[model samples]
Target chain A: MTYTEQLNAFYKMVSDECVQGVSLDCVIFGFHDTRLKVLLLRWKGTHEWCLPGGFIYKTESVDVAAERVLRERTGLDQLFLQQFHLFGDAVRYNREDTWQRQKMPMPFESRGWPERTLSIGYYAVVDQTKVMPTADFMTDECRWWEVSDLPSLLYDHRHIVEVALQTLRLQLSWQPIGLNLMPEKFTIPELQRLYEAVLGRSLDARNFHKKIMGLHILTRLDERRTGKAHKSPYLYQFDRENYKKALISGNLSFV
Target chain B: MTYTEQLNAFYKMVSDECVQGVSLDCVIFGFHDTRLKVLLLRWKGTHEWCLPGGFIYKTESVDVAAERVLRERTGLDQLFLQQFHLFGDAVRYNREDTWQRQKMPMPFESRGWPERTLSIGYYAVVDQTKVMPTADFMTDECRWWEVSDLPSLLYDHRHIVEVALQTLRLQLSWQPIGLNLMPEKFTIPELQRLYEAVLGRSLDARNFHKKIMGLHILTRLDERRTGKAHKSPYLYQFDRENYKKALISGNLSFV
Candidate 1:
């Protein structure tokens, strides 16, 4: 469908039910094969791509809108989503310029598009294996893009992604990771690789092991993975009680 | 002036120039006399208090709006302000109920006030001694209240302040503090007191001193504070270069 046609389909709800001048964009982060990936969607009838975002209904909270947006795209509800930042520059998106670039008609303020829309940016960590990517009405393609290599995103989306990643990286100091990205039973090296991908740098194996162990938020299982050429590493899972405690206390001392 | 009269004077500018359904609330935290204080304002002709907040102008970014709001209330510009959260529940402020409770006439949607508004919450660390509080057109009084003992705040402001302070406390894990809250020359014990005030708990003086020294973010001047009966303690100021580096790197290892 053309951009106008697609927008016309939901224009009423968008104008009346949703709050004007306020929307939400989510940076959905997924980890797989030791590579950090972000979910992006290709705009329908266009080559441009952007983060999976949606508008907030007058009845829904910003967080609820974020979760609804994420669920609509990922086919998963109740992921570990967090509101990281708000992108509210007056020139974040020039409507005329953006429409010209997209080769779409400019509906202007008459179509409920505010001159300056403030976006609440939320970041979520999910296991890539579980997400069944689905496209929304405005997008034709929904897939993961490697964080290190991304398409030239539309408007201020590139900056938004950078801020989201930076927020996630800094959050590692206070919040425990690998809970959503890792398997229930995984080895230390696998966990370290996840951390390395998220941090965008390698850590000393010894130091990483010591730090993760010191937190005591993980439980070493009696079982071990077999079929490796080398010595089988012991499998471990998050100590749910301790992990929840550390999260609530916000004192997880891992870098 | 009454609430209606106060809002009427700015209604034209607010309706025409400001972004609808979006506002900014500042949790301005100040440390004084071993207490953490928050700057609040009393609504005109009402006993209710709330965080000093303002709406974003159509031409201004949210950060700029926050800075503008902070400057208007504190009479100080360029504070160490940080956006921490967005409070956007539909029930955050029930306009009709709020007006009835405040014993004011409900202007409803006719005024600039929307049924639902999303607030960008920013937390600022400032030296209380440097602030000269000023009331705005909508408020009659502006001053500091010890966080431990606060009046019933309007709308969701009490919750907003809690979230801001929690964010500030968690931020101490990675971000250096006291630069904006402390005097130019302060002793180690004085710095410790500042941290204690923010964290809402006492710290071991020896341990705090050791940790702070290890961070190398402070420069011990060749001077001592000599106003007490006890031995004078050496005065120190933040090492500008190191402090900036720590802030940018977000790797400060103090809590």
Candidate 2:
């Protein structure tokens, strides 16, 4: 199909089934190489990046709509997706002219976008290696950027990202959901590094280890065998059953 | 003005200023006499009760709308309000006939409520004694109901209340926001009763006391002087400065 044909088809699809005044923007966080990252997308002809987002369908629950949007963008399913906040500022989309400046099709006004919108904010933690980020017809690139070093984002997404990070930090202090970012087996230092990245501070090694071990939710695995290391740290795996039980029993502090 | 005149004025005001597709429902929770209660309103001429709620104005944020609705219902400002969930099921208001059966005015349909609505759920903790619970033209009565014994509610309000309770329970495990429901000075047993009411389970007195005191957020006060009591239990006040500090430091576990 021609480029204009594709744009018309996209607009038609959105206008046909999408709910009038609601959208979902996802902050998909991943831990890789001891750094916390978030998935972002660049519109086909724009340098500005944005959180992967889409409109909610008329017949779909907001939760289902969020999950569908995330899966379509990341090609990963069943991640820990949570709704944290809703952004409904009156001027949330006042910068539609930016798309026109970028020489891209304007999806908002062209398709009779609702005069006002309430965008539901969802955050997900995923294993970075498992996701193969895909770019759609409207996206030129899709990639993960370190959370601490994000580029200027479109719309009010920068505020959304900041809030998502705050929510994740608050949630991490009480729940063990951060384990979703780790591989099947990881070293103690690796786990600590992930915490440090999320908390944006270096923790005392001894105190961190003591606190994590006291939770009784990790099973020690075989020692790492890196030849160049001074002394390889021991690897550990989350005891899924105990972790589930701890979550149910509550009061499992991680910070 | 006559009743019909008042109804028409209310509807006209709502339609004039409110956004078309979004609404805010507040689950105002209060603790009194060792029981957890929720503020509910009875639609005019109907027995059904519902969370005190209102639609967002075209120029207002959802958060502001929630706070406005809450303050209007409770006659209090700046309570511990937080957004918890969004209800967007396709059939959220499918039972419109419930209004017809009661011969009640349909504020939603009469005002051209959107084909689909996405109601944002906010939960607030307020001092029960401070609320006057005023009824509007559309409401015949407004009162508090025990969380465990709520009457039949309108639309999807029953589900909204259940989710609010769950959110409150989860939040109480990590934050000290529940102090909003208590008097300025309270006894240890009184605070424990609030926890018990929220959790719906009796906690061991010794364990509950030890855990609460360990947080170091309360200041001991002069003993209560109840004339008929076997013993006067000492009153305690939350150290407002330390409580604020603890909230900022971010690990004030209460449950």
- Note the Cα lDDT for every prediction shown: 0.85, 0.83
**lDDT tens digits, residue span A1-255, model 2:** 966688888778877778766779999999998899999998777788889999887778888888998999999888789999888787776566656644565455667765677789999999898899988887799999999999968778899999999999887877777568988888888889989999999999999889889888899976774765488777789998888887777676666
User: Who wins the DockQ comparison?
Assistant: 1
For candidate 1, what is the DockQ?
A: 0.76
lDDT tens digits by residue: candidate 1, B143-210: 99998899978878999999998889878866887899887888999889888888888999889988
**Clashing pairs for predicted structure model 1, backbone only:** none
RMSD in angstroms, candidate 2? 3.7
Error of 1 at A46 (Å): 2.8
| Model 2's TM-score against the true structure | 0.86
For each candidate, what TM-score against the reference?
0.92, 0.86
Chain A TM-score for each of the predictions: 0.92, 0.94
Determine which window of 10 residues in candidate 1 chain B has minimal summed lDDT.
Answer: B99-108
